[model samples]
Target: LSAGFDVADRCHLAPVGAAFLATTSSGVAAFDRNPGSSDATIVTSSMLPAYRGILLPLVYGPGTRSQRSATPPRLTHGPNETFIKAAGARSLAVLLDVLTRAGHVV
Candidate 1:
């Protein structure tokens, strides 16, 4: 598991192509499958901070079914601003393919 984030505003941005595992009226638990051979999980949980919002990262081991410290957020309405919703796991194959064929991140 990893650290937790608290949403502090309505203009927060969510990374695209990330998968969501849980959601509630106050927060959300989003994650992206590791793009590596180890297959570790990269999870981000955002909660409604009393007034603003925040984002944090949490990492989990590979092949685990249940998440321990990596819990979901309590989100009510859909993300107020930009949000990331990934459909598939990110693997080394995908990263290498993109890096080799698509050009570097600028």
Candidate 2:
């Protein structure tokens, strides 16, 4: 927990009401059917708002995922950071598929 966030801590914000799919800890999510948020899947603090999801495929591809060749490069984690996860080609492909199906017509 290098970020010092408790595992059980919830975000101070909630997902947008009409966000058919919201990026979440486990991946994009669909909230519960009922409105009370009782069985809803919530997003983590790192999630961008659903309104920004149209930017996902453009942002998640290739070097951007790990910032491997970032300009003025920086490591996302500290020396003690245990997890180093990123969306590789296949994962990006899957996300692209999801975005395509989301139908953001220009």
Candidate 3:
């Protein structure tokens, strides 16, 4: 149960050949601000060699405040619920793909 920031930091120190799947809502709202513009939430890090890192941005409802607020709102319900499930499914798929590429059967 690591925070997004923590996971991001640790990614730098992860062993070679390590695989990671992490989700975070941070910066998502800002990135999705433009109307009629949508980008894939799933991203892979290319800077980290020998590491397979997947980052899934969890979308929040419109008008949601920044996570840096003094009292950040909980995101376990409402429209976020859907995003959470989607992130989980994507994460699982990415994990399976990583394992398969490593010569492991799922």
Candidate 4:
């Protein structure tokens, strides 16, 4: 993430994007705040689809603090990026999904 993506400034992120990230990060942090809690107790279906199902195995929740996986999806702007030409809401939605997976706790 860029330095501008820092939640404090509200710089690079769209409003919804920032909110989603902030919320997700808080959830992760909450999990970290309590380590002895069983993983199953914290891994809830409310997680985004990217964080759900068998692939959930790929992520190891922090015991006492909120932490995200190493490689959450990213939304990049490039000539080949299809969503670039789409409507603003569409692109924003895609970007929000990426940020959500990245564990932004809005």
lDDT (10s digit) by residue, model 2, range 1-106? 1122222222212222222244443454422223222101233234456633322111222232335454544333434222225445455554555445455421
TM-score of model 3 (CA atoms): 0.28
How would you encode candidate 3's per-residue C-alpha lDDT over 1-106 as one tens digit per residue?
1222124444324331133322123321122232322222223222343333443333333333222223444343334322345545655565565446445654
Better of 2 and 3 by TM-score: 3
The residue ranges of model 2 lying beyond 4 angstroms of the native Cα positions read: 1-76, 80-87
- Candidates in descending lDDT order: 4, 3, 2, 1
By lDDT, the best candidate is 4
For candidate 4, lDDT tens digit of each residue in 1-106?
1111122233224544343445556453211222243344345434665543322111222211222322442233323223323344543554456556556634
TM-score of each: 0.18, 0.25, 0.28, 0.20
Residue pairs with clashing backbones, model 3: none
lDDT of 2 at 40: 16
Query: What is the lDDT for 83 in model 1?
Result: 23
Q: For every model in order, what is the number of clashing pairs?
A: 22, 0, 0, 17
| Candidate numbers sorted by TM-score from highest down | 3, 2, 4, 1
Better candidate number, 2 or 3, judged by lDDT: 3
Give lDDT tens digits, candidate 1, residues 49-93: 432233423243332233223336322233422222231234333
List runs of model 1 lying over 4 Å from the truth: 1-13, 16-52, 60-105
